[model samples]
Structure formats: structure tokens, C-alpha cells
Target: MPVYLDHNATAPVRPEAVRAMTDALNHVGNASSVHRFGRDARRRVEDARETVAALIGVQPGDLVFTSGGTEANNTALRGHGRTRTLVSAGEHEAVLQARPDAETVPLRSDGTVDLDALDVALAADDRPALVSVMLANNETGAINPVQQVVEIARRHGARVHCDAVQAPGKIAVDARALGVDLITVSSHKLGGPQGAGALAVLDGQSVAPLLAGGGQERKQRAGTENVPAIAGFGAAAEAALADLVRMTECAAWRDRLEAEARALCPRLQVHGAGAARLPNTSCLGLPGVRAETQVMALDLAGVAVSSGSACSSGKVHASHVLRAMGVSEDDADSAVRVSLGWTSTADDIDVFLDAWGKLVRRHGLAADAA
Candidate 1:
């Protein structure tokens, strides 16, 4: 069996989530109707919305359900129509894809946004500014200090938006606690079905609507509700919260994998080891071994992993995250990410470590003999 270690890309849907989604699929009614069936459907949708909101410690009315994280991010960044956007250098492509007219905030060597630098940028003339920093990095699992960043932005009179997609289920994310104007989360990253996500906005924070249609999501996201996916998302949030205790075990597995990789190849370096990180993620670099080559080798050995974020084009690229962290281009190109989740087991870790050892021996000897 292949040992799967790519939770940062997307997690497997949990059984409870699947069941909730299946049940919701059988019910029929538009969420925006006054009839009995419509009211029932609308009730289910709102109930799910409330559950999702509770998981993140926000009022149910504050959550705006969207297609997924990409849409949520777009709505958060573009909707405000701020003239300047101070986006972190290590942000996910969804935020990085903002218009060139927006300004880029270079990250510190540790992959965290430099708030002092951001303040300097925002203090010029006091125009409307938007600052977006991710709550966690997808590749390195480096957790950003969003609350601190929010404080800095707020002091400079700038609106703050956070992409908390990778932070959910691994770290605590209370929108009320973080005090950001907007936060984005994806259902798929937290063991829920894809095509379901939410953007939590504080009571007074308003953004331009991304979609305009029959009033749904309170005229915020105008479209027919994705009832099944929303139900699954709510169920998954409940299930993930129930398994918080399992995170410690997953961290042990990640540590063992890193130790074994270094034992096999002493030159291996784990990214973000000096900073706080999500316990389930590790990005490692092995000198002279290209990430794509190791990824294919691991696949052949029945141990699956990835160089970085699994791309829509199915091609491996050099990691932008590592580059922002000051890793040399060669080392960044050779990095691979291994992440764990609720379903990960010790046996899976054993399989991956054994496969990695075999590949290192085979390749290391071949290069030596030549």
C-alpha cells in the first residue's frame, strides 16, 4: 500500500462528512424560498453555517460560504478595492495573484511577515491599505503570527485579511481572537469535501460582492447553495475538532520521519526548524537530489509525497516558500514536503522511512560508483 503524506494539498474526506453530505444530497429545495421545502433546506444550510462558525469562534452571521479557498481569498483581497495591498511574499498563489497595482510585502528570512517593514510601507500618507498574510504556510507549515500582524496593520489604519486554509485543524484559529477583518478557510484542507469554504468577516467589515445573483449568502455570495458540500464541511469541522488530541501522535510521526531521513543522508536540512510550526508538516532538502526525481522514486516504492503544492498542471516547480525563507535556489529546487493528518498511522511512517532509505542507498551508491 502507498503511504500517503500530502495533507497540505488536500485531506481524505472523513466518513462522518461523507454521510452528512450524502443525506443532504437527497433533500431538495432552494435555500432562498418561502415554501415548506425551501424553508427546510434553508434551515439545514443555516444549521451547517452555524456549526462552521462555532468551530472558528465567530457569529454564524459573520460567515460567508464560498466555492472554496481560492474564491474566499479573491473576495477578501479584491472586494475591498484598496489602492495598495501589502501581501506577504510567502503567501499562497491565490493571494499572490492579485493585481500588479498592489504592493508586495517582502517576508523575513524565517518566512514570517516583517511587521515593522509593513508598517513603514503603510504609514506613507495614510491612504486606504490592505494587508494580507497567511496564517500558515502550505509547504513549510510555518505558522504566522497573525494576531501580531493584525495589531501592526490596525495601528497603521490598514485592513487585514488572513488565509487560514492551512491553519485549520492543526492550530487554533478564532477569528474573534485573531481580530483580523477577514479570514479564509477551505473545507478540503480540513478533511471536508471540496467546493465548500467560508470567509468570516467581522460584524462591521464589508467587501464588494464577488458574485451577483438571486440573493443567497445574504447577498454576499449570490448563487444556489452547495447544500451537500456545506453539510459535509460542517460535519468535518466537528470531526476534526473531536480529534485534536491525535495531533500529538502525528507530530511524533513527523519527527521520526525527519530523523530517519537525516540518518540516511546527513546533509538533509529541515525547513523552519527554528520557528514554531504545525506539528504534522516537514519540508526537507537533500543536497544534489532533485525533488522531482525523489518524488517519482518514492512513487515507484509505494510511498507517495510531493515536491510542494500539487499543481493544477501536474508539474513540479521550485518552491517559492523556500526562496522566501532564504534557501538557495538549488536547495529550494530539491525540497520535498511530507505532511501528516488524522488518518496517518505509525505503520505509514515506517513504510515511508523504509522507502526513503532504499532510494537514498540506490541513488547515493550510483553517484559514488560513477
Candidate 2:
């Protein structure tokens, strides 16, 4: 069996979530109906909403359920009628592609947003604008200075939309404390079903509906609710909160893997090391070994990793995240991202280390292999 280390892409569903989803799947009700069954279904969704709300320190009524992080991001981006946007260069493609005409703010070498550039970018435009900045980067796992971003946006009369998909379970997230106008979070990133996510707004902050139908989600998101997925998301959210204290526990194994690799190849480069990154993630580069080669070799050796961000189609492409950080094409092509999660174990780290050793030796990068 392969040791699954690509948890940032998608974590295995937790047993608690599976049980919640299964129970909901066995029941019947349209959350929009006023009948008893509908009321029960609505209760389930609201309970789940409360759980997710607590995860991010927001009121339950402030969130609108969505299909996933991508939709939540797209909804937040286009939901606001602001004519222009200023997005960080290191953000996920969802934000980058959301407002194609939005001006870009360059990122620093450490993978954090350049607040100086953001101040300038926001001042460059006179019209009211929306500023989209992620709480944590999906590829590098570097935490962005959202509070600082908010301060800058306030100076320029811009609203802040933060993509906090990689945050809840890995860090202490309080949406209100961050003072962002909008926040987006996904369930699957923390061991829930894939199709469930939410777009949360700060209290009294309004967002235009992406879909207009029955007055579901306070008319912000319309459709029959996915009861099973939402229940699963709630269960996962509770569990994630319980597990948050253990988030940094995985760092020991991650650092061990990096130390082992560096011992073999002294030229190994670990990205985002100088910044406050997610405890579960590491993006590393082997000087001459291509990312594709390392990923395939690790798979063959019963370990799983990735070449930075995994596309929606499961294809490995050149990392826009690395490029945004001013990394060279060659260095970017040679980088791979390894992320751990709730299911990760030290034994899994051993499996990855063994595979990494052979790959480095085979690629003629093992100076310390002896």
C-alpha cells in the first residue's frame, strides 16, 4: 500500500464524517420545504453550519454553503460588484482567474504578500476595489499577513476577501479577528466530503447571490442542500477543532524527512522555510532532479507526493506559486510538495525517506549516500 503524504491535495475522509454522511444519506428531506422532514434537514444543515462557523469564529448566519473552495472563491470574487480587484501573485488560480483584469501584487521571496506593493497598487486606482488575499498558500503553505492586508485595504477603501481553505484545521482561525470582509473555507481539506465548503462574511457585511432561486442560504446560494455532505462537513469541523492542537506534531516528521534528504544532497532547497508556514507542508527542490521524476519514483516506491499544486484534472504543471516567488523555471520544475495530515505517521515518513534516498542516489545527487 502507498503511504499517502499528499494531504494538502485532499485528505482521507474521517470515520466520523463518513458516519454523519451515511446517516444523512439514509434520511429524506428537501431543506427548502416547510414540512417536518424539510425542517429536520434544515436543522442538520444549520447544525453543520454552526460547527463550521465555530471553526472560523464567525456567526452561523454569516456563512453561505457552496460546492467547494473554488466556487466559494469565485462567488466571493464576482459577488462583490466592485469594478476592480488587487490580488496577490502567490494566490491560487481560483483568485487569479476570478478577476482576469484585476491588477496583480507581486510576492516576496519568502512567499508572503509584499504589503508595500499592495499599498501602492491600491493607491494606483481611484475607484473602489476588492482585494483578494489567501490566508495560507495551497502550494507553499506560507501564511499571508491578512491583518496587514486589511489595514492597507481600509486605507484605499477596498474590501478584503480571504481564501482560508488551508487554515481551519492547521491553524487557529478567527474570521472576525482577521477583520476581513469575506472568508472561504473547504471541507475536504480537513477530512470531510469533497463537495462541501462555505463562504463566510463578517457580521453585517453583505454579498450578492451567485445563484438566485428559492430563498435558500438567505438567497445568497440557491439549490437543494447537500444534506449528507453538509453533515459530514460539520462532523469534520468538530473533529478538526479537536485535532488542531496536534497540527504542529507532524512538523517533526516533516523536518526529519528534510534533514535526511539534505544529508544526502547538501544542495537541496526547501521553499518557504524562512516564513511562518503551515506545519504540515513542505515544498522542496532537488537541484538537478525534475519534480515529475521524483513524484513518479516516490509513487513506485510506495510513497505519494506531488509537484506543487495538483490541477483540477490531476495533471502536474509548472508551479505558478514558485514562479511568483521569483524562483527560476529550472528550480520550480525541480520542486515537489509533501504535505502531512491527521492520518500521517512517523512510519509513513520512513517510507518517504527510503524512497527519497534512492531517488537522490539514482539521480546522481547523493553526495552523502555512502
Candidate 3:
């Protein structure tokens, strides 16, 4: 059987989520309608809202459902009406492309956002500003000091938005505790259906509607909800919470994978090694082997992985996140991200390591010897 290690891109749908979605698909109703069927559908949607809200420590009423992480992020960035925006250089393209003109905050060599630079940028202008930072980076799995980011933004009267898409199942995420005005999360990242995501707006905070239509999502978003997908997302969130310990255990497997890989190739580099990272993720670089070449070789060996974010349209370009952390272009181009999830096992890691060892011996060592 092929071993899958690309959970950061998208995890295999959990059985609970699949069952929930199947049950919902058998029902027929519009959540917006007021009939008996409508009420039943609406109940499923509300139940899901409550479960998803609980996952991130928010009230059900504070959550607005959207298409996925991308829309949720756009809603938070554009709907907040902040004339000025500042995002970390290491953020996903969803935040970066949302406002191309937004000022960028540089990252430290460890891949975490530079808090001192953030303070200076926020102080640059008194214009209403929104600071967008991620809870955990998708590529390097680097965890940012969001509490400190919030503290700095608060001193400047700026609102904070955190794209927590990669953090839910891997680490503890508490929006209230983090003190951010807005937080975005996706279902697929947590083993749910891909079409569903939510944005948590703090009780006192307001974001203008990104989609205008008959009032839905408390007018923050306006579209007939995808009931089946929402149900699946809810089930996934509930399961993810219960599986937190399992995720923590996977950390040991991840560490071993890296340790063994490094033992085989002493020149192997682990990006963000000095920073606190998500337990399931490891960004490994073998000098002189391009990331795409390694990914293809692993696939041929029946072990699946990726070259950083899967959003790159099937092309393996140098990682922007690595460059932001001051990694040399050559190293950045050689790095591949291996992420584990609820379904991963020690056997999966061994298969990956076996494939990786061969790739390194065949190509990586040749370059080193040259």
C-alpha cells in the first residue's frame, strides 16, 4: 500500500466525517426554508456551527461559515474595512494576494514573525490597520508568537487576524486566549470535507459581509449553506479534539523520521528546527536535490509527500516561506514538506524514510561528492 505523508496539503477524510456527510446527503431540505425539512437541515447546520466553534473556543453565533480558508481569510482582511494591512512575509498566498499593497512584516531566521519589526510597522502610521499573522505556518510548521503579536497590535489600536488553518488538530488553538479580533480555519485541514470553513469574529468585532444576499451567517456571509459538508466538518472537528493526544504521539514519529534521515545524510537540513513547530510537520532539505525531483522519486517509490504548499499549481518553485526566513535559494528549492495526520502510522514513516534514503544515496550523495 502507498504511504501518504502529505496531510498538510489535505488529509484523508475521517470515517466519522464521511458517515456524517453520508447521513446528511440522504436528507433533503434547504436550511434557509422554514418547513419541517428545512428545520431539520438548519438543525444540522447549527449543530455543526456549535461543534466547530467549540473546536476554536468561540461561540456558535460568533462563527460565519464560508467556502474554505481562502474565503474566510478574504472576509477577515477585506470586510474589516481596515485602510491599512500588515501581514507577515511567511503567510499563505490567500492573505498575501488578498491585499497585494499590504505592508509586509519580515520574519526571523527561525521562520517566526519578527515581533520587533511588527511593532515598528504598526507605529508607522495611525491609519486604521489590521495585522494578519498565522498561528502556524503551513510550510515550515513554525509557530508564531501570536499572543505577542496581539499585544503589539493592541498598543497601536490595530485589530489582529490569525489564519489558523494549519493549527487546529496539530496544536491547541484558543482564539479567546490568543486575544485576536478574527481567526480563520478550514475543514479539510482537520480531516473534514473541503468545501466548508469558518471565520471566528470576536463578540464585539464586526466584519462587513463579503457576499451580499438574503441574510445568512448573520449577514456576515450570504449563501445557502452546504448542509452535508457542514455536517462533515462538525464531525471532523469533534473527532480532531478527541484525537489531540494521538496527534501529539505522532510528533515522536516525525522526530524519528528526521533523526534517521539526518543520520543517513549528515548534510540534511530541517527548516525551522530552532523554532517550536507543529509536531506532525518536518521540512527536510537535501543539498543538490531539487524538491520536485525528490517528490517525484518518493511518489515512484509509493511514498507520498509534497514540495511545500500544494497551492503552487503542480509546479515546484522555490518556497517563498523559506526565502522569507533567509534560507538561501538553493536550499529553499531543495526542501520538501512531510506532514502527518490522524491516519498516519510508524510504518508510513518507515516507508517514507526508505524512499528518502534511496533518493539521497542516488542523487543527493552524488552532488555532495561533486
Candidate 4:
């Protein structure tokens, strides 16, 4: 079996999610219709919305179910009546793509946004600015100081939008306590089926519709709801919350992988090691090797990993996150991300270590000869 170490890209769908989706698939109705079947579908959609809200500590009324994180991000950035936008330098493409006129916030050395610099950006006289930053980075797994950023944004009368797509099931994402105006999450990131996601706008705040149709999502997002996918997302959230024990248990395996990687290559640099990170993630840079080369080598050796953001996969560009962190072009080009999840086992980590050791040894020998 191919040892899947790329959980940051996407996780395998959980069995419970599959079962829930299968059950919901048997039913059919447009949630907007007034018929009994439509009412039932609407009930299911609301229930799923509540479950998603509970997962992130937000009121059900505040959640707006969308196609996925991309749409949610677009809605959050474009809607909500915010005039100006302030985006973090290390945010995912979803956030960047939605920001038509945004000033990029500077980043720290650990792949996190520079809070002071962000404060300066917000200090601009642009009233009612929207600040878009990721709760956890999709590439480096770097957790941003979102609460602090929000506090600063609030000082400047700015609204905050956090892309929590990579945070669900990996970290505690309390939308209320985090004090953000808007937050986006994707179902697939938490082991649910794709085409299901939500954007929670804080109480008393509202965004205009991204799509226009029969009013769904309380008219915040208008389209035919995908009840089956919503059911799967709800089940996945339930399963993931229940599996917190397993998620915590995977930390040791991740640490083992990092240890083995360090032992194999003494010069290996681990990003975000200075700050707290998700237990499942490790972003390491090995000098004298290109990230794509290493990724391809590992794939050939039956181990999967990523060079940078999965959204930018197959592209030959250096990581924007790394550059934002002030990482040199060469170092950024050589960095690879190895993330673990519920499906990862200790044996899988050991096998990965063994493969990495062989590859490192071969590369070291080649360097010596050169």
C-alpha cells in the first residue's frame, strides 16, 4: 500500500461519513420547495448546519453552507459590505483569489503573519477593512495568531475572515472565542466528502449572496443544497470530534518521523518548530535538493509527500508561504511538507523513515563525490 503522508493535501473519507451520506442520498427534494419532502430536506440541511456550527463553536444561524471552502472564502472576502481588504502573505490561494483589492500583510520568519506589520496595515484610514488570514497554513502547517490579529483589526474597525480549512480536527477552532467576523471550513479536510463546506458569519453580521437562485443558506448563499454531502460533513465532524483521542495519539508518530528526518539529515530545517503546530504536520527543508525532486523520489519509493500547497500542485514555482516567511529562494525550493493524520500508523512512519534514510544516504554520497 502507498504510505500516504500527505494529510495536509486531503484526508481519506471516514467510514461514518460514507454511511451518513449514503442514507441521505436515498432522499430527494429541493430544500426551497414548500412540499413535505422539501421541508424534510431543509430540516436535514439545518441539522447538518447546526452540527457544523457545534464543531467550531458558532451559532447555527451564523453558518452559511457553501459548495466548499473556495466559495465560502469568495463570499467572505467579497460580501459582508466590507470596503477594503487586508490579507496575510501566507494565506491559501482561495483567500488570495478572492481579494481583488487587498494589501498583503507581512510575514514572520516562522511562516506566520507579522502582527505588528498587520497592525500598521490596518492603521490605514480605510474604514471597515476586511482582514483575511488563515487559522492554519495549508503548506507549512503554521498556526497564525488569529486572535491577536483580530484584536488588532477590531481596533481599526476592520472585519476579520479566517480560513480554517486546515484547522478542523487538527486544532481547536472556536469561532466565537476566536472573535472573528467570518470563518471558512471545508468538509473534505475533516474526512468528509467534497462539495460540502460552511462559512460562519458572526452574529449580527451578514454577507450578500455569492450565487443567486431560490434562497438557501438563509439567503446568504443561494443554490440547491447538497443534502447528502451535508450529511457526510456532519457525520465526519461527529466522527472526528469523537476521534480526538486518536488524533492526539498520532502526535508521537509525527514526532518520530521528524526525529528520523533530523537524524538522517543534520542540516534539515523544520518550519514553525519555534511555534506550536498541529501534531500531524511537519514542514522541513533539506538543502542541496529540490522539493519536487525529493517528492518524486519519495513517491517512487511508495511514500507520498508534498512540496508546497496542494492547491499549487504540478506548478514549478517556489512556495509563496516560504517567501513570505523570508525564506531564501533556494531553501523555499527545497522544502517539503509531511503531514500525518488518523489513518497514519507508527509502522507507516517507520517505513517512511527507512526509505528516507536510504535516499538521504545516496544523496549524501553523491554530494561527497561532487
- Any runs in candidate 4 off by more than 4 Å, and if so which? 365-370
C-alpha RMSD for every candidate: 1.9, 1.1, 1.4, 1.8
How do the residues 1-370 of candidate 2 rate in per-residue lDDT, one tens digit apiece? Answer: 7899998999999999999999999889999889999998999999999999999999998999999998899998988889788899988888888779889999999999999999998888879899999999888889999999999999988999999999889999998899899999999999999999999977777778778777788888888889999999999999999999888788778788888878878889998887898989999999778888888889999998998776547777668889999999999989999999999989998888888888888877887655
What tens-digit string does per-residue lDDT give for candidate 1 at 121-177? Answer: 888748888899998899888888888988888887888898999887887779889
What TM-scores do the predictions have? 0.96, 0.98, 0.98, 0.96
Per-residue lDDT of model 3, residues 1-370, tens digit only: 9998999999899999999999999999999999999999999999999999999999998899999999999999888898899999999999999888999999999999999999999898999999999999999999999999999999999999999999998898899999999999999999999989999999767898789977888888999999999999999999999899897689999999999989878899999999999999999998888998999999999988999788878888899999999999999999999999999999998898888888888864732445
State, as a TM-score between 0 and 1, how close model 2 is to the true structure.
Answer: 0.98
lDDT of 1 at 174: 90
Candidate 3 backbone collisions, by pair? none
lDDT of each: 0.85, 0.90, 0.93, 0.85
Error of 2 at 150 (Å): 0.6
Ranking by lDDT: 3, 2, 4, 1
The number of residue pairs in model 3 that clash at the backbone is 0
Q: Which residue pairs clash in candidate 1? A: none
Candidate 4 residue-wise lDDT, 39-97, digit = tens:
98888888788788888989988998988999999998888687788899888888887
Clash count, one per candidate = 0, 0, 0, 0
